[model samples]
Target: MPEFSDELCARLREAFQRTRYDADGVLEALGAAAHAALGRGEPELAFRVSRYAGELGTLIRLFLLGGSEPSAEVEAALAPVTIEDALAVGLLRADGESLAAGLDIRPHGDEQGEWWVISDLDSDLLGGEVPPEHVLGVGHASLSLIRATIRRPVGTLLDLGTGCGVQALHGARHARRVTATDVSARALALADATFRLNGLDVELARGEWFAPVARRRFDQIVCNPPFVVGPPRVDYTYRDSGLAGDDASALVVRQLPAFLTEGGVGQLLASWLHVDGEDWADRVTRWLPPRADAWFVQRDVADPGLYVGTWLRDAGIDPRSPEGRAKASAWLDWFADNKVQGVGFGFVTLRRAEVAHPTIVCEDLRHAFDDPLGPEAGGWLDRVAWLREHGDDLLATRFRVPATVLLETVAGPGEEGWETTIRRLHRTDGPGWQHELDELATALLAGCRGALPLSDLLELLSFAHGDSVEELQDAALPMVRELVRHGMLEAA
Candidate 1:
């Protein structure tokens, strides 16, 4: 284990700031081509670009590119922090007359600000399979959870499986207090260093799943749990829970209600198994605890073969090798025996409501959406709650079309002439939801400008169509509720 020293960390921080080794600076140094190459893990182009960036380039090579530099060059790049200081902080090691990164340390941040994260070197850096206890740094899944999380201000928040504490740092922005827990002590050690480097004060706990925070409730909980569904034997502590297929995610969902306060929210990025003759929605809804409203969005699905291939490559196993083929065969057999038809990957947002049989929205939302979905998610929760309370009085409620909503019409040239064929409503913000509209619904929605009660507009439409108000209400209430639920119209 590496030692933690405030003096060493502070010195390293000043050196990083002085060299301008941040996200934007790195991007500027690498240019578009090299940065894109780096994103694909082909760092050769990035190495070529960084050669011209002076000290920033040197640091990138030493840390990100897994390259060693001469002792004199390393000292000049990190001036005040000597090679000995870097060694003491466990960031660099002395290899003959050169210094190499002991682990990967890079700058990661959002629009709020930039911060540094430290974790075990990737498989490429290690030149072999990752150790079981390897702690992951910032990753796509972690960023996905952060983007999906509703960042409303909260009294207390919990970040489960906080490998390297990336999500905990994000939660600290809106939360008064943050608690980060991980099952691996090595992960917590890395997380401790990450928090210190970023100057964030987070309570760190070590235990599996909810064990550390048992009997405690949080105002908000965000987790990117170990949800990879596979064989019982686990290799990576960061991604596998060593349980049977999908049991880890199921366990986390079952324990959510115990840790969330009333009206509290929980955001998770997880995977679930799909079996024959079982609806995916029901499988997920059954996992939800009582008094909890859930919004489950199934982002993508893969069959047994594809899922196995994907994870095998993720674990750094080269598929063309004999060992890799054997591992793939074993996983295929396991999936077949377990009757795993497919694996679904997605995000699940749970709100502990104050009512029984809480609202559940589970559907396959596979479209690309606007980033930073926090506000949209928070708004959706509020809309759902209000709908639950005022569903009966929607006819009398006045609603205005949101500024983000756009009605698009498509016309086609037919045998006679150009004629209108399709009309659909789309939201410009978050999710960018699109819905096709019927003729009467389009006319009705056009007049929803907060100028009149919905009932009045419906009555006018009823008169135009020569239909009774009761009949119109019965026919259109479901559509109106659907529009409101999806943020097409706002209650005035």
Candidate 2:
């Protein structure tokens, strides 16, 4: 079993470290390893390995495009994963190769152990002289979100913190010309390769945040920045943005105005501080730019200790080591000293509204959601302007939506329902849902041709099913909200 494991792990690491665009050899080897690993019936190991496919795809392309790395560094990253806890996120099986079901990882815990692994991409070809790396490799969930949430069309795209340039690759497919920028030259070089590998041609630049793009605005921007708080490691380029604590996420929020064209859209995955003495919502709200309306959803939060331990593991720290424990303690104290209650990890989306005096919708919600990059995301990008202008929300919008609304579902029938969200362009506050509901009431008002009042909406439904108006209203409200939230329906 050890010999078999070593061989299989070696292939996977090679596939990960060596595969490139149109280089199907490494991927094939990986697919075999993936199958073998799953056959071992290690669910966690299988899932863990699955993340590398996207990551390696980006890295190999990056390296192919003049991105060099140290051989020793690459070899270390390629080390085998045979430990139990390390194997949990993925598995190695000979017969259990088949996934139980396709899933985008749903992350919890403050430490974000798997995210660090998924987001960072490297190769061993260079001699480790290219400086530290800051990356934003594609994860299944984020890709899914991009595909699902974007409902409207786009003309130009910009990818910040391009990492392996996966999002830039996806954006290149839709936009006429894409500009993918990163603070790291390694990332930019790889982004160049990613474009070429995908048969795309993109504009690549290196700078801190918006420095390179100064005065140049974009129609659509995609960012997967490193919002991790405190000193993630000595690797400054990849981990620290030098933001004041959790305010790192705010860098994106703060600098948004300079780069967005009027009516342009930006989607981000960020983290915010759960300040000890203040409300997190308020703290994050301050991060929004002067005028851009935005929608912020606080998906999950983690405590200091759990957060510290989690990140320690991501750095592949050995719990048995005394040094690991000391480092863990320091990280926890950092979280505590800043008065951070918990760290907020979630999505923050912004769009410059067409109208002046924009209204922002800032919300801290607990709901299930998927990636915004799918077909739905484009529509979402386009439709958000509707919320920006008409104040008609998905849950409350009253436009006569297509009789058949689109349902973006995951592969399996048992997958959870996907929630739709709206973001502000810049500065804003909640009660965002109320505005949507108001519009919905109007839509119901107009959908009924003003022939019925809100109180009697239930009665109208009764005519269709012979059920009482109260019973129909009870069932219809949830459905209407869902539709409005998803951009399938509009406010009256």
Highest lDDT among the candidates is held by which one?
1
- Please identify model 1 stretches exceeding 4 Å from their true place: 94-97, 411-421
Error of 1 at 132 (Å): 0.8
Clashing pairs counted in every model: 0, 75
Residue 423 shift from truth in candidate 1, angstroms: 2.9
TM-score versus the correct structure, for each prediction = 0.95, 0.59
Error of 1 at 353 (Å): 1.1
For candidate 2, lDDT tens digit of each residue in 1-492? 012133443444444434332234333424766546634634344344544655452333223222322333333333432323123323211114221111111111111111111233222212232235534345443553344334345778888887766676566556888888888775565455444423456788899888888889998888877677875445446556766576668878888766889878788887777786788778877877666767676667878777777655444455447977887777777776777788777667787765566545455555444333234434444455555454433223334544343222223333465433431111021112222333233334345433334445655545644777666566566655444455555544
Extract clashing residue pairs from model 1. Answer: none
Output the TM-score of candidate 2.
0.59
